[model samples]
Target: MDTLRIQRMNMGSGLQNASGTDKAQPVGDLGVWHVPQYMPGYPTAATIWPRVVIIQCEGDVCPGYEVTPELGRGEYLFFLPTRK
Candidate 1:
């Protein structure tokens, strides 16, 4: 059976290569899939929250949406792929 696996590693701001060389490594499987950002509006402006959906699995494995609570400021959420 084929499935999508999400693996996480601690970069620690010191990602190194096999030869111990300093290198900038990606945070996720695909090297930082998406970066969510927000900026507050002016005094008369309103706050805009962010909503993101990431399909971690291939084909129809994923549930097509997030099952966890909404993401807060600077917070991240991970979901497991669904199996038939």
Candidate 2:
């Protein structure tokens, strides 16, 4: 998906009245460069760019969703992946 398409998403919010299993559509992958994980001040050549995937969540998986990433959510609830 394109940048505009990603921006148009709901930013990870659970769907009300959602039943059955949530379906996760693989939107795409994002490559972040030198993201400051710890030490929330500034990245002084110590931060590492981690690998993560972006998924367009559907149903209940939208809100408070979590996959098996090595580093978990980046201090945010949104921008997470869902199960297939």
Candidate 3:
């Protein structure tokens, strides 16, 4: 027998919404998948609150969109992960 759990994260509110292309609209289709987390050498804890996904679009108008003068090319996404 196998146990299954369903969890949904809405990326259309708070800080996420403030800086997203589709503030009023949600991105992608809603679906669920089975994922597993593994610990290598140490014990750790995980939480289920905030999750992020990357979104990228290309066009002539916004060819290689640059957010900052120093930063070249714009790779937009729902969440930016921190380096561990």
For lDDT, the strongest prediction is 2
Tens digit of lDDT per residue, candidate 2, span 1-84? 212212222222233334333333433354211111122233355445434545554433432322344444343222443435
> Residue 83, candidate 2: how far off, in angstroms?
4.4
- Write candidate 1's Cα lDDT for 7-35 as tens digits: 32232111212222122223456323222
Q: Which candidate has the highest TM-score of all?
A: 2
What C-alpha lDDT, on a 0 to 100 scale, does residue 77 get in candidate 3? 22
- By the lDDT metric, which is better: model 1 or model 2? 2
- After best superposition, candidate 3 residue 18: deviation in angstroms? 34
Any runs in candidate 2 off by more than 4 Å, and if so which?
A: 1-39, 51-56, 59-61, 64-80
Against the reference, the lDDT scores of all candidates come to: 0.31, 0.33, 0.24
Ranking by lDDT: 2, 1, 3
Model 1 misses residue 33 by how many Å?
11
Candidate 3 residues lying further than 4 Å off, grouped into runs, are 1-28, 31-43, 59-84
Which RMSD values do the candidates have, in order?
Answer: 12.6, 10.0, 17.0
TM-score for each candidate, following the candidate numbering: 0.22, 0.24, 0.16
